[model samples]
Target: MMPQQDQPANPAPLGLMAFGMTTVLLSLINLNIVDATLEKSFVLTMALFFGGIVQLIAGGIAFKRGDTFAATAFSAYGSFWESLAFYWVLNSEPIGLAPAASARATASFMIMWGIFTFLMWILTFKHSWNLVWIFGTLWMTFFLLAAHALRGTEILLRAAGYFGLVCGILAIWASFCILFFEHTGVELPGASRPL
Candidate 1:
């Protein structure tokens, strides 16, 4: 066997930070505390550019680092953000603006994401409980949002937003933990530094 070479750096923090910040901003809008039209446009831009493109790059790096989980999670969710942008933008059509997606369609879309998150959360147990909680809450948030969309109720959506906020905050904290772990050499409360 060839001698193993030094591995590349971890790519999780960049992807996690990108996803975390985007989620926080979007969750604020979902909470119904902001102007929907403006915030949505801005959020879509960030989703396409930062969340989509940047996370894709980070996932590529993770693949180079030989991390299957990071590669899969970051790349898949990056594509998800790009798909969200496509829905809001190109969905209008070449001739005339199409009608908004039906509630059922939207709910189904969210439910699919919930399913993906559930699968990813199962993988996160190997990383740390902090990562697990982030994915766990995020999984629930998607399902809650989907249920609210299906029911046409603000209550459930708002609840999902709150859960999303928690997920976002936890993700950011995890990113920080990974970034600073080398220096501190001690795990933060409810956080971990996965290799």
Candidate 2:
């Protein structure tokens, strides 16, 4: 019989924290609680480094651990962040693409992501209430942003920002729970089981 390899450390917490922190920052700007002046580079920087690269690393770890869901979530979202950062750069200032994309085009991009998030949320039912909530709010945030993009509605943007903030907080809580469990060997109340 072949011997089993040692179990890898869980990377979910790291991935979640990356997602959470990035989401929170962007959401704050959307909510207008923070200056949008930093939106041009700072948020994109976080998206590329922490949300994109870090999550990709976590996804790789999850893949090594044979966690299909985590691998998919991390890798896909990581790519989303990287692509989004590039998109903003391409749409802005010096490098702005010729015949720039229409608002409908941007709305389409957000809608596609919303659909993806919705699919992921469906799978979260088999995971935990925490995941369900996180994915649920996330999909809503995407859709709201898409609506705002399409209609140029400030209210929709604010709503998206609020939902995104909730999603970020939930992700952070899940990360903390997992980290706490890893350290204490006691599962916390939030992400212990499927609900």
Candidate 3:
């Protein structure tokens, strides 16, 4: 009989941290807690490198580990960050000079992401509470941003920022839980239990 190949290390935690950190930074800007200039100077760089490239690498590792859910989540969000960074970079001065997306177009973009996240959230029910909550707030954040764009309402944007912050924090906690389990074989709360 042929020997089985060793399994790859879990990649979800790395991807989760990447996503969480970038989301938190962006959420801070959305909340007006951080200087708006940082979005272009700092956040976009993080989105392109850490959230985008690193998460893409994690997605590839997850695919190797035969984790379809992690693979899809990491890949999709990685692309999202990359595309968002590119949107700003291409539109800003001394770059490609591409016209900025209109509010309608931005709303449409966010709505599409919201729909995608909602579908993914439905799938998270079979996973764990951490994932369920992470995806749940994530979809809400996307929808709230879409609503803000569509209605030009500051309240909706603020609401989205709050939801996004929660989602990012949850994701970071979940990442630590996974890392803790992998290191010490102890499952953190809500990490191994499904609803």
Count of clashes in candidate 1? 0
Winning candidate number (lDDT): 3
Which residue pairs in candidate 2 collide? none
- The residue-level lDDT of candidate 3 at 21 comes to 93
lDDT of 1 by residue, 1-195 (tens): 222368766778889998888888788888977678745578888899888998999899989888889999889989988888777775644523556788899899999999999999988887887889999999999999899988978899899999999998888888888777745677677664354
Best by TM-score: 3
lDDT of 2: 0.91
lDDT of 2 by residue, 1-195 (tens): 221468677889999999999999999999999999788878989998999999999999999989999999999999989988878788788888844668898889989999999999999999988899999999999999999988998999999999999999999999998888767877777675575
The digit string of per-residue lDDT tens for model 3 on 1-195 reads 221468767888899999999999999989999999998889989999999999999999989888899999999999999999999899988796789788999999999999999999999989989999999999999999999998988899999999999999999999999888877888889796575
Local distance difference test, per candidate?
A: 0.85, 0.91, 0.92
Ranking the candidates on TM-score from highest down gives: 3, 2, 1
Counting clashing residue pairs in each candidate, in order, gives 0, 0, 0
Task: Tell me model 1's lDDT, rounded to 2 decimals.
Answer: 0.85
For candidate 2, give the lDDT of residue 99.
49
